[model samples]
Target: MKTPSAFYKPLAIGAPEPFREIPVSLERMIHFVPPHIEKMRAKVPDLIEKVDVVLGNLEDAIPADAKSDARNGFIQMARDNDFGSTGLWTRVNCLNSPWFLDDIVEIVGAVGEKLDVVMLPKVEGPWDIHYLDQLLAQLEAKDGLSKPILIHAILETAEGVKNVEQIAAASPRMHGMSLGPADLAASRGMKTTRVGGGHPDYAVLSDADDGGARAAYQQDLWHYTVGKMVDACLSYGIKPFYGPFGDFSDPAACESQFRNAFLMGCLGAWSLHPTQIGIAKKVFSPDAGEVEFARKILEAMPDGTGAVMIDGKMQDDATWKQAKVIFDLAKLVASKDADMAVIYGF
Candidate 1:
């Protein structure tokens, strides 16, 4: 993964590191709020305390004529408030859109210092990241920015999925990648009319026997893509995220979807509505019983080598790794919440 010579390389001597490697636990939920909506911006400060990441959506949520308004709105909102460690991010328009270039220049030149991740939508390949990397570098240099702005790609197009590994390794400033199911479906000519949810009409059924009804096995449409994405991000040591689930009305389904991603190695998912925020946090966080079970396994394997039996279950090197994953997340989440601290400590 050779970095482009024209890309922004941090100068060492006096300033802090230009990029932030966001911890997995800190990114379990990214709430998408439209920047152009005054009502939304008015509610942002309150939302910040609840969500891990509040993305000022300047892309799909904003109307065509209102693109410029969203751009200006992002800068004003960014400067007017402080996001603390609850990362402040913005999604610019697509690479081929008219709004994309100005979105970067105006926002980055004005308040680029405040932004955590500049998310680009419909990224087709490494070329998209390379272009953004160089453009951001140019903007940073021109604006006299003290730190480099990081990049996140929306892996929506078929080409993007095909080359996702390269995209993950595309830029030195790449912070993460997200799975965008809506555009991905349209790009692949999928028949689903829904945003990102699974369709009941799509399923596998066994053959009927003796006039008995066949068993229908419902499946998740996003499993393969998300699993592949997790592998790609892990290989590059960057984060991977599950994109939005538009079914705000179905909390159970949303939780199940998020849980699947968490088990598959994703660090987070998008929360489109307020209802989705708590669901994501709960689903992505380590389960209390699971955490206790993991602790038992860890205690049983104190030497951290070979296999052992714990509560009638076989504990091996693989089991130890899995337990560590859950416990590490538990420790990180505990540092933020006093209640979680007590639970994890126990």
Candidate 2:
């Protein structure tokens, strides 16, 4: 464990000082772009407007031969576009992969200044974060960068899940974590091929009644994992996100899964397809009615203390905090979207 005196110190001489607090940004969806493809790279400028975080993915989907191309493409994408408030991120190859070293080196050397976050995949523990944190500091010092690039871990392996709390508190450069359900399923030897969402066979049947047909209601396979990740992240003051829902054909299911994560305290989710982008934005943003009610709560209890009667229900300090959550989120959504601002009466 790092001592309090050294926790915020730069790992390398002349490296920028570590951040005391993670920068606040409205990240509703991390839209993945396969940077190895030229056509996909062309869409990044427009994508910057639609998505909160535009991630150039150089890992899983890229062919082995195209790893270098993907890395180079991400650098070019970072250089050519000015992302403004929208985050520019990249999902580099995992630590175990041969391409991982070059992916970090070249991208940082070329466009470290514009890059917002580096999404590290399959991190098993705090050791992975420590390694990256030290390396980033060295690289940042060498490149004369002004700010530290944040590390976002992907919880894929079973060991990663087990060591999640430690990982969240691993470094001052830690931005957040995303739940990688497909790889996590494989790591845990779960009997399912789906990337995310609930499994049909993993359902519970209702009580049998006098020879009548029993109903089977499907449960989310990821609830426990998401809850665990959320708690660890919230405890450490980092964000938690839902990973990709691979079934592009089923928009309803994707919305449902995203909504569950949002209700459970996730700030965002991954969007692999263009259609899912809209769904993520809609699900992650606070509802208009809820925002209005939250506004009322704040008005009634200016200091967020004592009990008040609203709609025949008793509200105390607990409910005031709940209302603040919705109101704060609604304000963030309003900042980017003019329509939302009007609808939310912001």
Candidate 3:
């Protein structure tokens, strides 16, 4: 275990000190852009206005031959756009991949000042975070960057799930974690080929009725894992996010999965398609009615102490905390969206 005194110290000489608290931002959707494609890069300016985050994808989806091109393209994108309040992040190739080193070195060297987070894929343990943390510090020091770049891990491997708590506490650089269901499925030898969302096979049957058909209700395949991940992240004061939903044709399922994660304490989710962006914004943002109720709760319990009746339903300290969560999220949404501000009556 790291000594408390040294925990926040810079890992490399001249590196910026790690953040004590994760920066406040409304990250309802992390919109991914395939940096290797020119036409896609052209859409960045417009994309910046829509999404909370713009991530240059340098890993999985990029062709192996275009690794260098992707890196260069991400740099170009970073240089081209102002991004303003929208987070600028990139999903670098995994630690074990050949492109990993160059991805970090080139991206950091060229646009370290503009970069917000480095989304590290296939992280198995704290050791992975530690290595990246130290290396990032070194690069930040070398480039004379003012702020330390944050690390975001993908909880994809079985080993990653096992060591998630340690990984969340690995360093102050941890921005958060994302559940990479497709890769995690392969890691655990799960039978599902789907990227995310529920499976029909993983369902519960209603109690048998005489001469009647048994009803099967599908259960969320990711509930347990997402719960575990959310607990770890919230415990460590870092955010948790839901990853991709592969079936673009099924918008209803995507919205359901995103809503589940949001209710389970995830601050955001990845938007893999244009259609998913609206879904993420709608699902992650607190409902105006809920926010209004939360506001009423706060008004009733000004000190967040003692019990009170809200619409004839009793609320106490525990419920006060829940109300605060919604109110806080609604405030963040209000800041970013003028329409939301009007609707939320902020």
Best-fitting candidate, scored by lDDT: 3
Clashing pairs in 2: none
- Provide the lowest-lDDT 10-residue window in model 1: 6-15
lDDT score, candidate 2, position 142: 99
| Per-candidate clash tally | 0, 0, 0
- What TM-score quantifies how close candidate 3 is to the native fold? 0.99
Winner by lDDT between candidate 3 and candidate 2: 3
Question: Could you tell me the lDDT of residue 46 within candidate 3?
Answer: 96
What is every candidate's alpha-carbon RMSD to the true fold? 2.6, 0.6, 0.6
**lDDT for each candidate structure:** 0.84, 0.95, 0.96
TM-scores for all candidates? 0.93, 0.99, 0.99
Clashes of 2: 0
Give model 2's TM-score versus the native structure: 0.99
Over 1-346, each residue of candidate 1 has an lDDT whose tens digit, in order, gives 5555523345333323445454344888888988887888899889878888889888997899999888888888898888887888999999899999999999988898888889999999898988888788777777777777788899899999999999998866888899999999999999987767678877899998999999887789998999999999989879899999988888888888888888999888999989998888888778888899999888888767899988888899898999999988887777665676786675
Badly placed stretches (over 4 Å) of model 2 are none
Off by over 4 Å in 1: 1-25
